[model samples]
Target: MPFGDFQKSSKDIQLLSEHILAAECEVPGSGYNHSEMDLDNCLGDDNGNFQWGGRNFHSHAHNIIFHPDEGVAHVPVLRADLDGGSKQSNVNLGERIGNVNGHLVFRW
Candidate 1:
């Protein structure tokens, strides 16, 4: 497959996973507990965000990716789950320092 097609397909799969995660919840009287669903393993936290390509993504949910029309080539993301749950945060983008050891690095 061509690279663009492969990339698009990959994004489609990711989007599907995000949908499944969003629709997942405890079903009352269904004899299945939330733990039984094992959805926690697929998420990094309660925000339904997951880690991929060394960045945080939420598909159609809250995420840190700068879109092409945003005019910014990249934006640094820093996530913190204060109050033991996901909350809105103000972030500042730092200088990109490229990748290191399979990890994306930035200079603050």
Candidate 2:
């Protein structure tokens, strides 16, 4: 397949995962105890934001952040683990850097 198609498909999948994960995160205490679903393995935010990410449990794990429109997409990734758990820790840095949402400057 062409690289463009591949990239689009990847983003599509990312979006889908984000949707499911985001919904799951919304319901309090609705995950962990189930047999069909495993919430512990996911990387998500409790704030119910539309953004979420994750990766496989490997020997070594690093950050994998993807804001989609963000220029770098995933920054400070030490390895290609395909997960954003590590990157979650650095979100404050971005906030410190600043998030210009219309007239609101979401910053520390």
Candidate 3:
């Protein structure tokens, strides 16, 4: 996680930023997987500097298929946005599920 030192806010006029280099997870037993890779930079004198980096791959699919007995879970989050080389905004969160003792918060 690198890139967390740029703070300038005046009610948001394009200087918003975020930084996180790596986040990892893995829990076996047929479900639980996580990942986060980020380096998002947005600066605007007129949207001049726009450096984007992103990778968020998440998974949690227990006993699938509409509550098959005592299981029916979902969490399929995937995002990929890799900067100027180009690979913009790819998202898939189906219904947004996966919070096994969740705690990953960063604010600046």
Best by lDDT: 1
Residue clash pairs of candidate 3: 1-21
Worst 10 residues of 3 by lDDT: 7-16
Provide the TM-score for each candidate, comma-separated: 0.19, 0.19, 0.18
Q: For model 1, what is the alpha-carbon lDDT of residue 12?
A: 13
Clash count for candidate 3 is 1
Task: Report the lDDT tens digits of candidate 3 across residue range 1-108.
Answer: 122211110011110122332232323344333433232321111122121221221111111121111214322222333333233333222222122322122332
Residues 1-91 of candidate 1: C-alpha lDDT, one tens digit per residue: 2111111111111122322211122233443222111122332333333333223223224433322111253332333332233654322
Each prediction's whole-model lDDT (CA): 0.26, 0.24, 0.23
RMSD (CA, Å), each prediction = 14.9, 16.6, 16.7
- Backbone clash count, each prediction separately: 0, 1, 1
Note the residue pairs that clash in candidate 1. Answer: none
Error of 1 at 67 (Å): 6.2
Q: lDDT per residue, candidate 2, 1-108, as tens digits? A: 221111221222122222121111112233211111121233334332212233222222234343433444432111123243433332211222111211111111
C-alpha lDDT of residue 82 in model 1: 23
The alpha-carbon root-mean-square deviation between model 3 and the true structure, to one decimal in Å, is 16.7
Ranking by lDDT: 1, 2, 3
